[model samples]
Target: MPDARTTAFDIDLYHIDAAYLAWKSGYNAPSAFELFTRGTPFRGGYMLTAGLEPAAEFIGNFRFTREQLAWLRTIKPYEDEFFEMLGAFRFTGDVYAMAEGEIAFAHQPLLRVEASFVQGMLLEAGLLRALGIGTLIATKSARIRTTVGNCSYADFGFRRAHEPIWATRSAYIGGTDSTSYVEAAHRFNIPSSGTIPHAIVQAYPDELTAFREIARLMPKYMLLLDTYDVDQGIDNAITAAKEEAANGSGHTLMAVRIDSGDLAAWARLVKSRLVTAGMGDVKVLVSGDLDEFKAQDLLATGAPIDGFGVGGNLAVGLGSIESDYIGGVIGAVYKLSWIDLPGDDDDRMKIAGSKSTWPGKKAVYRFGDFDHDLVTLDHELAPDGGRPLLHPWMKEGTLLHSHPSLTEIRERAMSNLAAMPTWLKALAPEQDYDVRFSDELVALRDRIVAEHK
Candidate 1:
């Protein structure tokens, strides 16, 4: 008889530990782990390394509550040893990974964890969940960063994101300079930025009063124009900038944001109005359904828009490039490459069907000139027989890594964007990069197939 209790694992990489607990406790992980386990040697060439921090956090805290264990015991015949194992579930695995902010391509051993088979196995659910979701957002945001060029962008997807932490961290990693989420800013030290919502503009008797109240509170606040009348909103915003300047508050109306209508046209019109009103230096910002293509289209006009407030499409993503949106997708797979049990001469591999994993661990190298378009081998071997992709992010539960400020990450992302190849940078027809495994890995793969047969 089939055990209907078993379900699939449907999470990003970092959420694997949580997925394990959830699966054991009668909640479903994302995809079918049974199927995943069957494919011990995955077919894919590389995986996007992501979500290691969150996955590590989940693994370090993975434990079954006594209540949960007791409930499990009540269900059916249970082994005392198995119950004890559950009680003491801790991931003492060591993970080698690329630094979180580093740019990575499709197929490279992004993360490598070494631990007892069970320990590593149990962490899969949570790890995949965290990594998958984050990478998706980061990849999507990278494209927007490309199209928008030097213009600044902010995260405003707090209300729509699956979790607040996800919203905050995802936006941060996805290349947004600041966020509208106050709690995210407080927790992660990410800067909190916002003008007023359209509701605030509509709440007052007139747009001028609403603008006045906001400008008074934070004199240099970014003003949102287009609650009802967009043209009038610009006029009102100009009036507010003038008043703020005359009051000798030293508060300059920093920027005015246009949310709807033909953004390029409206931005130009608003810029003209501000210049006419002697507030020529005041910046114009734009939002509402912003994506990479739209950002490029608006930028092409050379509008006076200073930056953007990217919400839905950027924070989550537009859609998949080659795979599905949900499920344990990203086609990001972890494969068992070596089996060395003490007495073995060297590492061994197991190959079956389209599943043939390279053995003896791996490293990646960039083979091209980074100065020109920054093209890289998807995963090139370093002559030293070591993997270059996995750099030290953390060591022994200590955050040995020093993450740069959000401003810094934004600047670095911009630099990377400028250097990326035109063909690979577009968010369409997922660019196919090259990754080559060493002869030793190929030999190991061949041996596995022979032994299994």
Candidate 2:
């Protein structure tokens, strides 16, 4: 345990201050409760469950450093005995979750963790942090991917997301063809795509010379064609490409990117120009502030762009979103849903206004052809045709399954989404997909409510 341990993102350290304060106030709860809800209102009908492996990794390796324990003694509330207890903390729990790429509906628990109340409580924040950002990016990425059909796009949102690495990974799983983050490229083995910035074109004595030099070094690179003048850059690139072909070099690229201005109109212009300039094989790529909404709009109007580079809209999702019918940052959360005790089994729930959650250890099951979903109690088996959604990810504190590769995950997303109704796929759909409560689940809710009343 180096000091760097605190610098990283782990619930043990990330929630250390909160955990200490809770201990001081005797803020111990006997059971974990689901404030009973899930889903981002503005993000449409469903979310993609992601970051489970990373979340599991954190819980498995979490530890409190000596310095952390020593500092705890100085923090106002935590007792020495508490620090002693902290010295032996480990997350011994059972976790069930929707697979990483699974589509989740509202009020369905995407993940459930059964640990002692305190341990589970401390995990809420970090788990939410991971799933919130990961799911948001994945959902956002999926929108862009589904909107474009076969047209390609890259996750160029690294510069925009709060967690650059995680966001890129989420976007990849969400469905981007590639990323501009070089480190993530190797880490995930995804294609890394980038090209000369406007700065390179601006610095050159002539755009042609810059392209020529770059082509010599990286012959397959896509050229940035809007730095000086979109048309001029294209002309220079044509001359450079001819030169490369003559010399048996720089012969691979068939595309140039336009980063600014009216992208839809520009995409059409670039396509026409590339065809007339004797480089008809060359394609047009557009980058800038693009999202699924904007891309969807462009495709609707028949933009001739070959690819899109989505940045801010994909990277930095609703940063502080807090509504169901409206939009902003994703509203993903984590909560304890069930607890087992000697001679007793309880399903805990919160009835807080506007934040109420379904009570119990619950499981989600999907209905016909991905049209609707049912949220049911975990113990009460649904004998109906509903297919169980949550699978065992961890048991006895050990990871029980291997995650699919990014490629496979993306394929799952594409395959499943294809079955989704067209109306539900709309950018801002007029109607939400149906998410029903099982009869048993509803009956349990009624019984619990009657008891309180």
Candidate 3:
């Protein structure tokens, strides 16, 4: 699904955890959670990390609407003081995170948050939701890009996107050259691309007339070829192009789009006809149930496809989730890693075995040209020839720096993908690229587990 929550008002739904919110806020015993969140697509060994900027933006502007607060008051176990404090709550925490578009491996903390128990805990749902959907789209887009190479890929998932806002953004970040989501185009400064629907031809006297009118209205147009017979649609497109050329509007059909039939065969036939008619400059665009696998199959036929409009599958992630707006959610968690004890600073972690987590503030460092990563205690310095991946994205409620433009972020994503090892990039991974955990940290975790057991 494309971006779901367009306005801040829609965020009132985060009020879902009112009781826990009230309880954690007042439980004053020096509580803290080292939010070591990680999320990815299914069978994924590596993910192109993203959503940090949006998550930070949500945190920096954290708020409960008046209606949301009023509703929270209706829930049981929430005292007046809780509501009073909730109305004034601000995320005055410190955040360290991998830059959006960095390559992130499994079990590594893509983001870490430090603040009081409540300020941090309250943020978990929103942050994880944003991170999960964005990460999913980015991962999927990269997979398609790996297969598509230099051809242009645009996001046509806007209508089917569970939500439009993040979905479009995710698709773009994931590597779509353009998007059909108009508002997202305006907001992100991305070039808007879309084709006329079948309804346009239906509204007109005939397909040829619709194409001619549309071409007159806009010099460049991708005439939808499947609304009627695919063959006739191409013929109409050529006629419209010729008529427009005679009108001196100087427009030829930008491309001929096929939304149905065998994409590969149709694309080959369409390309062949366009060439026979001396319109070789025109391109063939195809769209119909496209995932990376389908896109791969289409390309495998050696069809002359110049562009694609990917829907449904691109909107859904590798795994499915029980949600109306989205088909999936990444499994991510926030847990207490530290709680101040008088005169004591022992490392702390959950001891659930296999569900256990590392303790203390953590840092992720990359070795070489994104060959691998090491997760170490924050105080430890980067290894020789190693570069720290996490940087101070935010500090004490203020942004540490302006966010990189989406173009820059997309370039970074492409760089990360280009460096990926072939095995991990396989649709079914050959092996996992584990993030090396520090020896001392592992020992401390073992010690904690033994004592708890």
Candidate 4:
């Protein structure tokens, strides 16, 4: 792999080719692009907007390095002038986006870019990647949080994540209390959480030894059960906790993790044993292929599960078969909305079948407790008591304000979720949200369609 320090070449080759062609033709006029998805993921009513920080970072750092330019030269015989243009390329754009952790709906522009045509085209791939994965994981995490309800949840999906750092950050934005990925924890300032793995128990000689040693070494630690036998593991954990208390080590047993077999039944058994031993304060955290649906089912069983450690389902975007949530991709697309030329500004859109896009620069206005949203031309007036979801984040490629801390973003997410109607927050939301276009927007679309025809 190439050095990770430089992000110059983190773009599709077609964008470069198109930009080169545009440079040759002198067609780099002012343009606008909007990033949006047509539907919600997870069969849910809404999506949590995330990744704006990373996307803004990408735009701010847009530039070509000498090494990257040299590497590009070897790919094909390109003119030196084109390379010089690339070396001097910068994203002198204006960006409008929803704040990280805000709730969004279908057809809303999560992000909008206004820049030169070449600059906007070059941003497509990276913007999609950042916003897509970040939003997907955040939405999934929000659903999990809803199901778990007041329970401490940790992201334990580093091994299953396509990109561990991004997954960890997105999970935190969507309401996870902590993450198991140490690098992400340190980098993003997220709380790190985990329990002793099965390997640790095997490495020690026996499960009991592992539990005892970990309890002795750490002030607070979670013991991993089911390394050998679930019953024996529980007994060992209890003994270790009791010994730690008697020895006055000041150590405390935080929780016990059960990673195998019928988790609900095992959680019940573990909780029962802990209560009987007068260690009822010991929390129960369960893992192993846990998803929102499974977590909901487990909680419904009246099991005394104190927390959840979700892995693949939380990080990998594997749509729940039970909930019929679409997975694998968030389906966010960046499309041209308008272009400005000499003495003429033209609204643009794709007219292809179901892929047709709305024309012109737009703004989404929410009315009456998010009861409905209206998409209208950017120049349109907002109705009384309306709130605009998108706000200026960047001007001429510079941030307008400092990015919010992760804790702030997580709190915003929880607040947004709390304000949503109950039906929309349901595990399987079947009702369609009212997202309509203004009368003027509809007229413009019709006129544009007629002109195309």
Clashes of each: 32, 7, 12, 0
List candidate 1 stretches off by more than 4 Å. Answer: 1-50, 320-329, 341-360, 368-387, 392-419, 429-431, 446-453
State each model's C-alpha RMSD to the native.
Answer: 7.7, 3.5, 4.0, 2.1
lDDT of 2 by residue, 10-112 (tens): 5545466656665666654455433223555455766776777567656665666788667666754656787776777777777777777778767778778
Report the error of model 1 at residue 346, Å: 8.3
Residue 371 deviation, candidate 2, in Å?
3.3
Can you give the lDDT of residue 108 in candidate 3?
A: 72
lDDT of 3 by residue, 1-453 (tens): 223432223333444354355455544334445544443466566676667666866775677667767875676455677677767777777777788788777567777777666666677766777777788778777877777878888888877877677777877877889988888899888889988899989899999889889999986778899897898888888888888888897766878789999999988888888998889989889898777777777888889999888877787663423212222556666666766656766457877756778887777888876576788887776678778887887788677988889999999888878877778777657677757888877877777777777
Query: On residues 40-142, what C-alpha lDDT tens digit does candidate 1 reach at each position?
Result: 0112211222355565566555666777668666753556766786677655445666655555654455666655555555666666666666655665666
Candidate 2: the clashing residue pairs are 35-357, 36-357, 36-358, 318-328, 318-329, 319-329, 321-329
- Candidate 1, residue 159: CA error in Å? 1.0
State every prediction's TM-score relative to the real structure: 0.78, 0.90, 0.89, 0.95
Best first by TM-score, ranked: 4, 2, 3, 1
Relative to the true structure, candidate 2 reaches a TM of 0.90
Poorest 10 consecutive residues by lDDT, candidate 3: 318-327
lDDT over C-alpha atoms for residue 344 of model 2: 50
Candidate number with the higher TM-score (1 or 3): 3
Task: Give the better candidate number (3 or 4) by lDDT.
Answer: 4
lDDT order, best first, reads 4, 3, 2, 1
